[model samples]
Structure formats: C-alpha cells, structure tokens
Target: MATHGQDPLLHSEVRQASTGGYFAGYAASIVLMLAALLVTQQHVLTYPAFLWVIFSLVVIALVAQAALFFGLGLSPAQAWKSVSLILTLPLFVFTIGLSVWMFHSLAPRVMPDTMPGMDMTQQPTLLE
Candidate 1:
C-alpha cells in the first residue's frame, strides 16, 4: 500500500509514467501495426523475407512499448524488475524459435509437397 503522499504510479517500485511517453508508445504501436499490414497485403517481399521483416518490426514495437508505456528504465527502484524481465526475455525467444524450427523440420517428413490447392490427406481415385 502507498503512503498518503505517494503517487499511485510510484506506489510500486517502478518508474513513473509520463503522458508524452504514453502518447509516443501508442502512436508508434499503431504505425508499426499499419506498416505490418501494408507489407503483408502488398507483398513487398517474397515469402520468408517478408516474414522476417515483419518479425523485426514486431520486436521493435515491443521494445518501444516496454520503454514508453511500461516505463522500463534504469531507475534505481525498478532495477531488479527490469533485470529479471531482461533475463527471461531470451528464454521466451528461444522457446518460440525452437518451436518454429521443430515445426519446419517435421513438415517435410509428415506432409509431402502437394499442389497449392490440393489436400494431402485425400485418398487417390483408382480410375484416374
């Protein structure tokens, strides 16, 4: 619980929030989302290239959100929380990366290449 004079923002051991920072984060988030939609819909790059581009954009947006909206900074009070979050971030990234790798590795063996519109699980016709 906060003492009588303490602001709610600082009630916890975290950095204080600023109105300008919030606005910047919100605007940046919207812009990044729009950019992602445009890149995907317009097909600016082919296949994996565009996918990687969007992934990079998403990471940037997440960082901006964390810094501006969540007030993740080098404040003395917030130091431990910030450090823990940073430490755990790589674990999350590695989990996602490994999952994608596993899926791609198994895809070829479990599902053979087929026509774009064809269903791989369908039975073949004997007459045809």
Candidate 2:
C-alpha cells in the first residue's frame, strides 16, 4: 500500500506514469506536426528533398511517440517492446514493397499500350 505521496502502483518498483512525461510527449508531437505542416504548406523543399524531409519527419515522430507515449526503450525492462517493433517494421515494409511490385508487374500485362514508343497495333483494343 502506498503511503503519503507515493504511487500505489509503484510499490512493486514497476514504472508508473508521470504527468510531466505525458505533457512533454504531447508537446513534442504537436510541435513536430506543426513543423511538418510548415514544411508542406510553405513548400520549403522540392521534389526528392521534400519527400525525404517528410519521410524523416514521419520517422522521427514515430520514434518520439513510441518512446514517450509507450515508454519504449532499449532498457532491459523495455527491450522486448523495442525489439518487437524493429522486427515488425521490416515485415510491414516488405509487404508494401511486394504489393507495389505485384501491381507494377500486373499493369504491363493487363493494361493496353498507351504510352509513347510502345507498339499498340498487335494488342487487342481495350474498349472492344
């Protein structure tokens, strides 16, 4: 049982939520979102640079949210959660990559030739 100001949940020495930590995490997310918006709405970057910047922001936001909101870290107590996330991320990326590859491969076989420099006469009419 907790006495005075001690958290009852922390009696077992397990981590307990801190108001300050939650607020800091919330503030960081809000700031990051605002920054990403500024980069997009103001056209701060162009083409590939823009894409990379947005991607980087997204990645940073993901890490920050995970660490702050979920208490995820490489510490022994939290290592499992971090490891699980790392392992799962690659699978998600692979799934998306395979889907894109499948679609790209399928398009050529199923769609009629409409682009320039491609032979269009031999293939049957798309509409008829």
lDDT of 1 by residue, 56-114 (tens): 89999999998888888887766777899999999998999999999888885566553
* Predicted structure 1, TM vs. truth: 0.73
> Local error of candidate 1 at 126, Å?
32
lDDT of the candidates, in the order given: 0.82, 0.79
* Best model number under lDDT: 1
Model 2 regions more than 4 Å off: 1-8, 11-14, 105-110, 117-119, 122-128
TM-score of each: 0.73, 0.70
